[model samples]
Target: MANAFYKVPQPVNEPILNYRSGSPERKALKEALAAYKKEALDLPMYINGEWVSTDNKVAIHPPHEKKHVLAHFSKGGSDHVNAAIDAALAAQPAWERMPWQDRAAVFLKAADLISGPYRARMNAATMLGQSKNVYQAEIDCVAELADFLRFNVQYMTEIYQQQPNSSPTVWNRMEYRPLEGFVFAITPFNFTAIAGNLPAAPAMMGNVVVWKPAETQIFAAKLVMEIFHEAGLPAGVINLIYTDGPMAGDIVFSHADFAGLHFTGSTKVFQALWSMVGKNISKYRSYPRIVGETGGKDFVVAHPSADAVQVAVGLARGAFEYQGQKCSAASRAYLPESLWPAIKEKLVADLATFKMGTVEDFSNFINAVIDERSFDKISSYLAQAKKDDGVEIVAGGNCDKSEGYFVEPTVLLVKDPHYRTMEEEIFGPVLTIYVYPDAEFDTMLEQVDSTSPYALTGSIFARERSVINYVTDKLSNAAGNFYINDKPTGAVVGQQPFGGARGSGTNDKAGSVLNLYRWISPRTIKENFVTPKDYRYPFLEEA
Candidate 1:
């Protein structure tokens, strides 16, 4: 049933709220956090619009306060995964056939709900569950999640409006249809917004989804499912499940209805999934669309002309925020020897003022890493750096996990630019600095490009316009989202579409129309207004 053309409401980025002292938002957020901590919730999986529970329960704990049990989620096995896939496939036809405007309305309502009534709860969940400070939680769980939902609806409209040209005698049209089967969305623990976006993006494009969120993130992810339901999302459109990765992959990848994958996780896991898909390609109905955003060894480079204070602030904020869990976090830096002394002074001074503790304390700038596994990995790196004569610990090299998994924001000054910590990904609050001669800036740029297999995010600081231009061009392939004088993190949706290439990801540019294009299969149709009586052309007639 087709009617008049409709337009969705224009999307604007949600304003970030600063939880100032005694502010209403701060008080409300405090109450929400206290309320969540008072009760230990029993969470369940959402399949076919039903909350499915099992006897197998996994306790969820705050990364910074491991003694407190926040929630316990029901974990399922192969049967539940099969049920989720079956539900998605069964729901696919009705969902894809619905009017695009109606589908857009569901997500738009979800955005409004997140922005208004559910904002505090969502933020609180993220703060306690993922061990994020209030500021980080507000930006991620509330503002960024709402932005993704709203902006994605706008992107979907732009996609459907595209059509082909037609002549007077014939009519042509291009129909953007949803992929043949369900999409598998595998989300990570670091970002609640990403968890929502990975599944919601594909589902908004008229495709059904089976979403699997990270175990550490399910505490907040359960709230995401609730918000979607309250927004009037239809049954089975998006089915959230909790199962072991290998068990789920074994069933999903081998199924005939496997159509597409929207993933945000480690690069190695993405590669393994791709390999599995390739081996089972012949079993599927159509070629599955694989889109992923993976790891980053992000960098920050400073020119001799760059201000020392600004460089220090960039390194402090870019490398240590959110315990350096962000994929785009600056893990390595190249500072000119001329500016090293001043930069080091300011950086150390700034690190001295950072308070590390649980998220309940608003003043703490640093918090725990995601879990014990991350803590061990980061601690091992710190231990190695301490013993290595080639590197010197400049500031904050402490690890304590008696109550929570916490590693102090550690800095390593390495003599060699190609040291292991500089090239490899240590996804914690550890920033490695290498001081190079000021005259060898170009050589350093070349080394930067070759140092890491990742091309995620990077920043170059320079006052001179020529130096800026020269470095920008030289490091063209070094990063996907490059900055001139700012930190490489905090890429806003619609402003800087985020992704990377080489070893990082497919660079599909999430939050843009480009990522939406992957979820659709286009078909061009041509209709002839008049038919020829005889099977003959003008050349065959009477030339």
Candidate 2:
């Protein structure tokens, strides 16, 4: 029930050369500038109530232009992980015992901190560290972080204050208690907003947290912790350790106090974690909740009546934004045969107009992949896709990683919807297009359901009155976050909860008020205004 705030000084901006010219002088200048940038913004893991950097470090290259390397992050290990978990466990009692209003105060203060001047630095870190373009980084990392903080405060307050109608003889009250111990968040690199919400949401609901963000995105995650501290959250309320998945999983599953996991990553990784949790489910003191949003083979459907410009813009941005590294990126497109040629032509024309470069490059529309591993995986998919029968690489499949992990925005036309490229979650800037014959809508729907084991998200584009309602009804369970004329990646905090079921994940959307429900155990508290001397009420006694 105590608080303290630290005022973080704003970072001063300095001008640096751009990536347009590959001249040796410009290259040296950029490298030197990056060294200064690293010195200016080196971040560490927040463990055991302290900010500490690790001995091991990992390099980050900006995805926008690939002009220079970004800051190196602390590559924390098991020791760091255990230390953080210990801190969270120690802090859980005090945090949980605090009044809900006090807890809600921290969230409000955090929202204020995010919306203040510190937002610029958070935005910059997201842009440089993850190579997100301005709009993407600002919305996901800055604006959305604030939104999550604010929404959860209002949400948890209402939840804790819920009351039901009561007769004169009896009174009933509801209580929502945090999980027995610390909740752990294992997040991905795609959305910095998630890195903020996954842990904060649980903590705001009276649970402590241990977060293990992807190593590549540690910088952005670290900045979020600073905001938490600035908001006057007590030390040890939330813990962060930057470690790889397997090691982190070992720590999470083996710990007796581990309560739940809020995860976002590949399907394979989620499966492994799911299996690990299952192995210990019986032996644990208490059952831990499992919530995840994994890989997605999301799609975009365009009807013959769809607008050419609208379809073209949606497809291009949804396909190539963040270099298509998002789980909800539109990897597959289903076009009615009547609109196939027109859609393709418009898409090709718009793609040609896109500019590719580093985050600082104003003209660049697309950025680099997270690292070489992703670069190799995406390139390999493109290569294998080229040799496959009944598939045509349409728009862009060129890859140039001589400088950084870069792949061109690629489009493939599949002769059959069952092709591997069309079915799998490629997790890159590669998209597969399928042309369906007219009057085969039902068949196409069946094919879509069968081909995609992941139903994380999908979109439908049509103008007819019945079309919207029909598509919504048919694809009701197809996606956790569906779209009519929007991209799947920009799911807001309060409006629509994000996440999916099936192979996609357990469908616990991170930003929704519903997410807090998963981290807590609801206990009903009943008070008898007058003693119930008799055994039961008339209905129960009669039965």
Off by over 4 Å in 1: none
Clashes of each: 0, 6
- Number of the top lDDT candidate: 1
Whole-model lDDT, model 1: 0.94
Model 1 per-residue lDDT tens digits across residues 1-543: 668888778899999999999999999999999999999999999999999999999999999999999999999899999999999999998999999888988999999999899988999999999999999998898888899989999898888888888988899998999999999999999999999999999999899999999999999999999999999899999999999998999999999999999999999999999999999999999999999999999999999999999999999999999999999999999999999999999999999999999999999998999999999999999998889889999998999999999999999999999889999999999999999999998899999999999999999999999999998989899999999899999988899999999889999998788999999999999999996688877887675
Candidate 2 lDDT over residue span 494-541, tens digit each: 777788988899887766667778988888867778886878768875
Where does the lowest 10-residue lDDT sum fall in candidate 1? 534-543
Off by over 4 Å in 2: 1-41, 63-69, 532-543
Among residues 3 or more apart in sequence or in different chains, the pairs in candidate 2 whose N, CA or C atoms overlap within 3 Å are 63-368, 64-357, 64-358, 64-359, 65-357, 65-358
**Residue pairs that clash (backbone atoms under 3 angstroms), model 1:** none
Worst 10 residues of 2 by lDDT: 8-17
